[model samples]
Target: MAKDGRGAPVGRRVMLGVLGLGVLGAATGSYVQNSYDNLLAQISSRDPTGVTGLLPGGGGFRFYSVSESIPHRSDQDYKLTVDGLVDRPGSYSLADLHAMPSTRLVRDVQCVTGWRVPHYAWTGVKLSDLLDKAGVQPGAKALRFTCFDGVYTESLTLDQARRPDMLAAYRMDDKPVTAAHGGPVRLYAAPMYFYKSAKWLSGITVTDHVEPGYWEHYGYDVDAWVGKSNGRDDDPTS
Candidate 1:
């Protein structure tokens, strides 16, 4: 139901298969960009890979997506809907988000799967500000984030969602976020595992209770704090 990166409305693409990163790059004609789109485009244009985990960073870190093909969106056609259990439901365009006060977080990005990318920088609007702007209603105890990718979803309790470090991010590493990296915007949950920060972010629904998200439903902890929730003793990221 959302538009692709080229501004054309498209259905959610499913992950069908995965090819080796080396073969993917060679067949696709260039080294995979650190972003999501180039790699996904190569996959979509050729074969499908259920490549949810990607080590495009020369093994320094990993980039991942659950689906084989990624959804794309241009800022001009991108829209974010904040609704469900709010007194003042709102829909925001990319420009509207850019005008808001932004917060920058330089925190370690940890994946529950055991890789870490330290001191990555993210820039975006505070989720708390957006909730306040929408006038969140009483009994809304959790926030559910739905991504344009169609298969991924994540949640946070009201307290976690309001953390000053949590952001609805549009920029990463001092540059505009690319499609491969979950732009025009994505969520950044600094204290939680990387999966808590959903990419291709599209909808925010306020709910009366916390519903376990995509990975949580599959055995990952719903409250995915870096070292605490997943039973690993890694140092905390925040």
Candidate 2:
């Protein structure tokens, strides 16, 4: 009788031990499934169309498709020409540009596709200063910018072009830009996404009205504000 009673309690203990193991297995399975789902969600998520590609440092960088790539020329070969509508249509070499007063700014670089890198340091001449030197005409309501990438072009109103935030950048992060990064010269429009900052930039033609650029013609908003334009609901980096 004592042996029977002991067997009954042992049997109950074994059952409880098996039940605990089952519960633990179920919990572990649920945790693994949830973790897998979360990883899949992150992997499957797509960036918005026209968004800039990621850079090496875990920072977001944007690329503008230009018509043609202009090889980086030395100071002797580099010539920035101003033609279109100006009194003193002239050409400037790299040396001439370097001689001019320089301005340095630190601003967030926003991309239309939904990425923003803050505090990118840029050093260059002000667009307004250049326009002033070129002596833009009274009829000039817009400015068309051309790049070495023969396919890409951008246009901005005179008011927009003259904004303090607009820059004809020569350096990024305290160093000269490289060919892979639109070097020698590039437009830097801090208020807009990096695409608006045309790479391999060459020409600035002042005109009477706005002209849609490459991306603009393809349905991108002309005025690509950080959070307001491009059909994005993201917050502004600025």
Candidate 3:
């Protein structure tokens, strides 16, 4: 959810309706549901149409866009860059990222607003591998993530970024990430709130200190550990 610029539907009221609708749709006819979902998926850009988000959701993911009508990036045009406070800066195409060592994890995704998707399969390259290859320089304290969606941003301490669970994810449910899912690449912040896992991920920059993300500007916790911050007391996500 963009505190302002983020187009995602982070508002609790909107998300409540979204979650409610999907469950309601499940009781309807299968053919009717699938047809509606297919039509919406084809037309969706950053997310399936806002209306479709109310009809049926796949994999328990709640759907909403960062903003209005964000043009989806094609697989051939996607690139992810790693730079800032590093000895070696690099830009990687989707193919280049895919060629690197990959890791797969099945982790539950928890949204700060109170919804959870359990045992979701995510596959990607570890951010630690990229940090090591980039030769993190002395005094670097954190990593900031920027998204192609043009509004949402996220951050982690260097120590947090180096956690084995952090990833630059490219696949989900054993399928190549689709635009509706924030694809060809996105940040998979396994142990944090789902919002910390920025969608349409494009840049990773090492920095001297942690930078507040978009949502942070509007009072959401900067350190969004699931069930830990923001008045939520629940299970540890990891």
lDDT of 3 by residue, 128-165 (tens): 99999899999999999998888888899999999999
List the pairs of residues colliding in candidate 2: 66-149, 67-149, 67-150, 67-151, 67-152, 68-148, 68-149, 68-150
lDDT of each: 0.84, 0.76, 0.85
Evaluate model 3: give its lDDT. 0.85
User: Any idea what lDDT model 1 has?
Assistant: 0.84
Ordered list by TM-score, greatest first = 1, 3, 2
For model 2, the superposed segments whose C-alpha errors exceed 4 Å read: 1-57, 62-70, 234-238
Per-residue alpha-carbon lDDT of candidate 2 for residues 25-57, written as tens digits (9 for 90 to 100): 787965665565455434434545422233222
lDDT tens readout by residue for model 1, 91-171? 999999999999998988888876667678999999999999999898889999999989999999999999999999999
RMSD of 2: 12.9
> Which run of 10 residues does model 3 get worst, by summed lDDT?
50-59
Worst 10-residue lDDT window for candidate 1 reads 8-17
Error of 2 at 216 (Å): 0.7
Model 1 lDDT at residue 48: 46
